[model samples]
Target: MVAYKSKVVERIRLPSRERRAAALEEAGYNAFNLAADDVFVDLLTDSGTGAMSDDQWAALFRGDEAYAGSSSFDQLTSAVADVMGFERLVPTHQGRGAENVLYGALLSEGDVALNNTHFDTTRAHVSNQGAEPVDCPIAGAHDPETDEPFKGNFSLERARAVVDEVGAERVPLVIQTVTNNSTAGQPVSVENTRRVRAFADEIDATFVIDACRFAENAYFVTRREDEFADATVADAAREQLGYADALVMSGKKDGLVNVGGFVATDDGALFERCKQRAILYEGFPTYGGMAGRDVAAMAVGLREAVEESYITDRIEQVRELGAMLEAVGLPVYEPVGGHAVYIDAGATFPDIPADEFPGQALVCELYREGGVRGVELGSFAFPETDRPELVRLAVPRRTYHREHFDHVAETAEAVLEKRHEVAGLEIVSNPAVPELRHFTASLEPVSAERAAAADGGSE
Candidate 1:
């Protein structure tokens, strides 16, 4: 297959090894702490890290700077309605901001919010509101080697059981994270969404979608599901959205924008409530927390993201990288996800214990060896959940080319060759609040030997 032409037009210089080492120590061995100039390949996240297209850059110049009732907001609203099938739109700075507003409005003390799997911020928001976030992912999601097309799907039986246990009144929302971020970026099916919607209706629960990667999920549906084989990517996306009463999106992901998000719904009452909270937490209902320029770019991005050629190219790029790692006998999540490829860190480095943060150890080693930065999605990220320790390589949209991925694959192979030498990390300072410590927790090497192992055994 011929590859898509590379579009990168900018580059930055990487710092020296000494500088990189010092940065790591200062940041407590966290990749998020490393300076952008010190890294070569940064896969820390796809959020707000992608390169904007020529069209998006042009849109930025046409932005309306109005505090309220801007033309740019109108454009964004139309885009959301057309692309996502949502009748009402309330913008936010990002996905989490949308969650804070919507969940803050709907959830009460002791309410249960269920999902296939809650990403870090989603779970945090639910917990912050004194509500329980219950995960009901399909059985196949636990196994890295499983090839389930809809591995991110929530089990209907589990949802029913939860509803029965909690009673319909206590269950406020049932959310489905399309292309589940916590479970290897797996795509959920349209059929599964419909089932979940029906279940939600049965239990008098509100059906919401965490639709950060809705376009990618649509592409997967078109490719894998026979019923949607004849449908265009946009058609499949609309179908998926049709099942949800409301959705929260991080435009940073599928919208192909650097910054923007929204809470969109068809329910007028819920929309009013969410808009009220949006004004309190975010900005006005029209602008939410984003600038008029960001609104313009997101409008364009929403359209571009669902294009057949672009979606296909994006998924193919991720697949190519996954194949490279798997070819070299790396333990990656099977059937590579739409946005990232997950490395089974625990399986690869059996010598490192779970308590020692094996996934984070790999993250540090990758950066030290090749200046490549990735994130650990494991016990470190979700301490209470029984999730496998995984090192995620999230590809920024239109940021890197095939050669860049080739370099990343080679680096992983190099690190794995000496996997036995890799050591674990010990947290030095944790958050006093005890919520999402991986973001700000400070850690140190257990010993000098462990540090040396991460640094590729002395020079």
Candidate 2:
């Protein structure tokens, strides 16, 4: 096989680590890319799906096709409606656009958006459309790498905080199920969801759910946690789904297939408005915003996603990996929830100052040395000042094996061997014009010349 190089002759950042430091040539680095055949685990993105027989997918295809192939958007919407159990189905071109376009029509400027956490795109979209993204996660309620169950539900106090700040009339709250991405991938509790939704109603605020990792979140709450220990996974998921005014999920995560997302709601007006925007960006109101095969795949994926066995195993797996990382002496987040394992880069490289963007440095290091390309959670993904530094390792559905996890453990140990080499990132510039740009930050360099000097190689 033509080999992909694994060694890093230069400094790099390890994603989901302390900081995005530059790994020195002296650090004995290797890349973490799967293509390089070096990385053993991929816990950077929640893109995993349970495996199935070809017949299963084919059965979904029988009911749906990959492309519309001249099928009307209404037909698409009907299929989606049937799949999601909604009263009226409308699919459109809304996912790729900003939160403003999707929500601006329903909300005015200065409106409040409350959620346990905000995915990068959703936050950018909401802010671009003139709404404020308010994140109030529950207290110490989660650990992402160990499947600790639901610890990330929004709080009644936090809800009251929103009502206190924006008043009930102008504020609408959003609840994200499963991993509270910004808060270490924690799952929100069903009880928390019930309370938050009830509070929103009390204050006359609309409650929306972000179901990007809903299935994984369900696994944690139903199969793992004490409160939900008696409930079936599907029952818990349906209950969570029932609490929201509407729910939107990223297509790549639990929704089956690698493409398409859905926004479910009972509000006819909201549905109408979202469909109008969806047609502009996605396609038509009937199909919302998806292609044919993906539509079929998602239809099937959604059905399978609700199954307890499929989701439970996947959610548990991430926790298992996180526990493994913790066992090896890495400072992993406690109370694993769903999807990713967040590494405390700040804790990992405490000697490295926060100003240095240690998490960024760590991410770069992991990539260079291990060829793995997980994303950085520090300011690289969110604002560093507002939140603590972190490196996120998302686990895509059905993407890796146990061996991959082992490789991650290996790279982590190797990177720790050169812990002193990790450095923090300094933001060079930040502009907020386009909504999605919020995720990737531009930064100043750190590890190059210092490592050269340390090794007595070159300046």
Candidate 3:
């Protein structure tokens, strides 16, 4: 890949080790609490963190900031139609906004929504609506050591079980998260999507594909799935999206923009309900919650995201980082998913248990070792639930280069070398944090006295 623009070098502010320790203590050991200026390499998230291309930047001029029926909204709708085979659109501020808008319309109290795997926000939104969000990912999804190409595929068996138990009327939606984020960004196969569609049809539930990383998932389908081995990225994306009754996308991801998301459907009645929710919760149908310029940029980004070259390079860059970590004997999630590299923190630090938050311990150590910021995607992210312990280093799109990843790999190695020294964290207080406690929860290192007492009691 070649650069379309000149490299803009910004100084990476590297704080001293002592300064990092002080910062960690002050922030209560939460990486999200750390200042961006203090981080040398920030891999906390990919959402709204990528650099926009020249075309997207130029589209900003086309924005028409009107209260209704803006030209930018038209551009977005046209792009969605052309790229995703959808007829209607309801724009939102981001992915979660789209989820809230869509779920708020379709779901009622005691309703059930099934997914291959529900990321934190989607699960929280479903819970907020008093609906149950059930995960039905295939067994392969949970095995980080298994190199399955389509680990993101839904478990049809479990899906059937849930449907049977809940009865079809109580089940309103079935979602497939492309490149399932909770399970290491793994790609879902076209065949699996077709099966999911059939199952959704049988139960009369809406089949919604979460299109956050749709392009990346398509690229993987082209490379891995034999049926679509010769298909273009756009064609593969159309095939996958074609099976869905509706789709919810985060423009921050595949859109390649700083902020935007949308829910699209071909069903006119469903579209109207989504629009009502969009207006009630977000904004007007046309502008929704995003700015006009952001709408225009998302239009450009949606098209750009499906380009063969761009999608290829993006997935390969993520693989390159995964390879680097594996070279150092790190327990990386196999097949090196689409958008990020997930480390098996539970395996890395076997001595630490889920309640103590091994993933958070490793996340803290990565920052202290070399100022590299990664997020914990495990028990901490899904507290009060039994989940695997993992650390996700989500690389932003076209933002960091080889050198940055090299530094990240080196930093990970440094932390691994001293893994025994890492200490678990405990929530300072139970004061009502959000359901997604990982975002704003304050934690401190488990005190030696407390640790000893717990160990003695266990013995």
lDDT of each prediction vs. the true structure? 0.89, 0.61, 0.90
Which portions of model 1 show Cα errors greater than 4 Å?
A: 1-8, 448-459
Clashes of each: 0, 92, 0
> Which candidate leads in lDDT?
3
| Candidate 2 lDDT tens digits, 65-178 | 334443433443554454444555444333334243356545667777777776677676677667887777665543334443455767667767777766777776555545
Which residue pairs collide, candidate 1? none
Predicted candidate 2: what Cα RMSD to the true structure?
A: 7.4
> What tens-digit string does per-residue lDDT give for candidate 3 at 1-459?
743453555678879999999998888899999999989999999999998888888899878899898999999999999999997999999999999998888889999999999999999999989999999989868788887889989999999999888799999899999989998899999999999999999998999999999999999999999999889999999999999998998999999999989999999999999998899888999998988999999999999999988887888889999999999878999988999999999988876767789999999998998999999999888876555788999989888888888888898899888888777889885435355888888899888997888778789
Show pairs that collide, candidate 3. Answer: none
Residue-pair clash count for candidate 3: 0
Give the CA lDDT, 0 to 100, for residue 251 in model 3: 92
lDDT of 3: 0.90
Deviation in angstroms for 397 in model 1?
A: 0.4
Write one digit per residue (lDDT tens) for candidate 1, span 1-459: 432454557775556667777878988988877778788999999998988888898999999979989999999999998999987999999989999988898898999999999988899999999999999988879799877888988888887888789798999899999999898999999999988999989888899999999999999999999999999999999999989989999999999998989999999999999999999999998899899999999999999999888888899989999999898878999889999999999998887778889999999988877788999999888887889999899999988988888878888888888899877899998885455888889898778766556558436
lDDT score of model 1?
0.89
